[model samples]
Target: MSDEDSRPVHIRRRGLDPADELLAAGPLTRVATGSGADAGSQWMATTHAVVRQVMGDHRRFSTRRRWDRRDEVGGEGVFRPRELVGNLMDYDPPEHTRLRQKLTPGFTLRKMRRLQPRIEQIVAERLDAMARAGSPADLVEFVADEVPGAVLCELVGVPRDDRAMFMQLCHGHLDASRSQRRRAAAGEAFSRYLLAMIARERKDPGEGLIGAVVAEYGDEATDEELRGFCVQVMLAGDDNISGMIGLGVLALLRHPEQIAAFRGDERTAQRAVDELIRYLTVTYAPTPRIAMEDVTIGDQVIRKGESVLCSLPAANRDPALVPDPDRLDVTREPVPHVAFGHGVHHCLGAALARLELCTVYTALWQRFPTLRLAEPAQENRFRLTTPAYGLTSLPVAW
Candidate 1:
């Protein structure tokens, strides 16, 4: 359980909890190299405070990969791959600021609220399908996997008929178990799909988020930015919510008392949703941050050009973050956690994520009051290979 253990942090979870070593690690530790873009060793920020510092101080810890030594050999190396253009996570302050500003209006509280009715409808449709599929259904196939994508389809104005194809690309690209070439292929296809959507929005915009951005930003928003926004939305919105739903439901099944609390009043459900997000911390790390200059954190001095990967799950589980950090207390007073990340690059769709989580958790249980795992939790499959921690299939019965 030494902090210096160089295991890949993303796969460190033992079910819904962060691996003990990750939680036990000091503020910063060295992670083995193969997991990051950097050719040398990468450092991990495990404590809540240190992780916050690494993510928040973009000046010192740059998200742009070229800032790292790995990309430094190439000339002026700021050239982004086709996939990264307008990717807010890959840009620093001014560029990130520009893209984020243009997209901010689409994710504001009011905008997320505007999308709620459609979200609820999508959830209900998935639930109805689950009912038709009958008991012992895989919640992942029946509900978890379908809802987020369908909702996002509605959000991005993906033609209702095309959502299945869109979801396939998302799954293929995110499956880390797949070969790099295959994943890259999926990513290329996904980008092409977004580009087509962006083109359509240019002429006659629709009511979806993509169209709204196109209409509002007009020629000001480049197709690349619009595509980037779509890519980010589908990437973040689909898998994270799907993972949370599957894992969150599994966590609740084991802790039945928490479900009772989660099924309580509106305010209680919202708190439970937030606590689940923190406890599960499904999207493991944000993009690895590279140091632009020497920086001191605790006893460690990260020299310029070293890569730092902040462990979101580890940081959330750090005792410094809350009492009995590993315990899931849905009723605990909301404590700020980095599940949605921190700083200016914090998740743009966080509000939308919360609304979806609250709606899904509350409504699903309402529809199936007796829901329980079809098998023991320990025997269930955890998706260790994906970027997000989730169940490969969550078999449940009412």
Candidate 2:
């Protein structure tokens, strides 16, 4: 029931249970977004209903308007050459259609289920390593970053040994603290690194997603397009997956009873994963949208060319979405939440992410029944600078 009513949407205390100031000022109000003098205000879709309205109605609120189309080819905006922009977040309709069609098969239910066994093995391996390393292990380093990071690497055909480089690149690019030039360089470097793997996959479809895409499409898609697509999907699950794993463990340990419910059964743990995603809302703010034309959402009219932001945590935590909204109950029945977003722009890696979470929570806790925070929960650093919200390092002792 308590939401920040007066304070700005972007600023919040940086730790576990950070104070949410956006709700205090009231939901669905305009607030200045950045710290700079040139910072302009935009309407924040804070409630579950409104956020879905904007994301769902892609026609009215186009994500492409934020960038100029003049730099790219055709009407596809920056997505024309396709190497310039990340997947569907850039293009609309036919352009989005073209790219989404090619990538869809790689994320199919069959693919996820197939990946499940490998994911469990990865989880078990990391857990075994942690056990060998003894208690008081840095879960973020040993288990969290390692588990999903490796899965994503394998999925994209990146070598598991090279994870450190990509992890730095992924985290640095999403970081808001870094200069724009610095972030752009990191992103470009990430794409370039994937180019090598894509080239390799071209000659031999190596069972990874990049190889899978080449297998189906053949020469229909250019290397550049495939490279950009690979880069986007590779990083898609990078921070969010690892963040959820680390944060999920932290949340479960805090509520030990909930931990017991998720420790073994995959079916129950799968449902609990959705609840955890809703409760955490770790990706605090994703890309903002701009109105292609004047759009009326709820009682407010968002004018043409205006940017719209969605506060994921606020919307997911909205009382209207569920009773006792702020309480983190793993037993809550699944409701429509915008944690992975809604409609056309909904997360492509969502199914894969859920499978990863289910495996992590179940296999991880089963391995360490005595898992507890190495330091006080308040002492752990909250990684607020990046696009996603997660712990910088989670120190846990079993």
Candidate 3:
């Protein structure tokens, strides 16, 4: 069948279901197959086609302003919550290049290597806390949720006492069900907190990234800009890493043989992490991009100013790209996946995220050889309604 003729068939086959099942089923479905505002939206059903088109031709598809637009919608305006997080991730060309140049140095292999020992210490501390809390503890509530935020706080120079509050603020903004009033309050409070932290860093300066950014930029970086970068990095780093840890653990539990292979051989952890990222495609969908110019994606004509959402989950699972994509195989060879995204707006913290995932999976499985889900695998809650997909709670026992 022609591509156009197959679109409807694809849509009909993938019908709307919970977000978890949508993911568990595999990627590259017809967008109209799902419920939500995008349901039946022509642009939605063509997600897989559009992603292939975009990845194949980067010039026509841009990520600039995608996340910014989401922030505007989520924050309600540029003046409040949106202002608290920086625009580094949402800019194009020269500006993005400039910011990335300044920031990329810190995420280098040398820097990540230095952070490794500390990450292990932090992981052990968290696992110890979980052990103290006893069995059947929520994996998300303890290790997956807390470790990344704490690590981010240390990296950005947030006071140790304030890490919990910072995490809470991050969640409040990301949670769609949060009332406008609550978001506003959280935004304002976070802005004030960040501004204060930036001001203090300017005066005393520390060994962390915030101090380094301040030292390099000095007076050139305004309070708003510094605070924005901190908030953006913190949120981006914490949320994705946390979700991956929780989801990776769940994946291992579901596939016992894979888990055994991974734990029995240290070499398998890296490949397993890659496969989990590919299979889970945890971020779910890419931010909607507005066509800056008239663009032809595949056979479809996309008009200027129209919105296009790329479902990473679908793209990662495209049968054309990954053979037998539904089957989880830790032994799968290195294959390029868009879990961190594609194009200029790809995730800046990709290396750090991978490090954390490797650490979590390696440590968790090794520490608790008999680890298994405390609840029925099917009963576990997955975050299907959000822009990012993950579990709310991952109860486990050893």
Which candidate number would show the highest TM-score if scored against the true structure?
1
lDDT of each: 0.85, 0.76, 0.69
* Every model's TM-score: 0.93, 0.89, 0.82
Lowest lDDT block of 10, candidate 3: 9-18
lDDT of 3 by residue, 1-398 (tens): 63323432322112112133333433223245445765654354223444756644445554555344544422333332456335564554565677766666556787778788888889999999998998878999989888898778777777778778887887786667888889778867877888888888889877677677777777766787677777778767777787778877887788788886556565677778888888777665555565667876556677765556666766667666678876788889857777787767777788788788888888887778888899987787765444455678899998
Better of 2 and 3 by TM-score: 2
Cα RMSD for predicted model 3: 6.3
Model 3 misplaced stretches (Cα beyond 4 Å): 1-42, 45-59, 66-85, 264-267
RMSD of each: 3.0, 3.6, 6.3
Q: Global lDDT for candidate 2?
A: 0.76
Error of 3 at 110 (Å): 1.9
In what order do the candidates fall by lDDT, top score first? 1, 2, 3
User: What is the C-alpha lDDT profile of model 2 across 172-272, one tens digit per residue?
Assistant: 77777789999889988877777777788889887778888889988776777777776677666777787788888888887888987676566778779
Off by over 4 Å in 1: 1-7, 35-39, 67-77
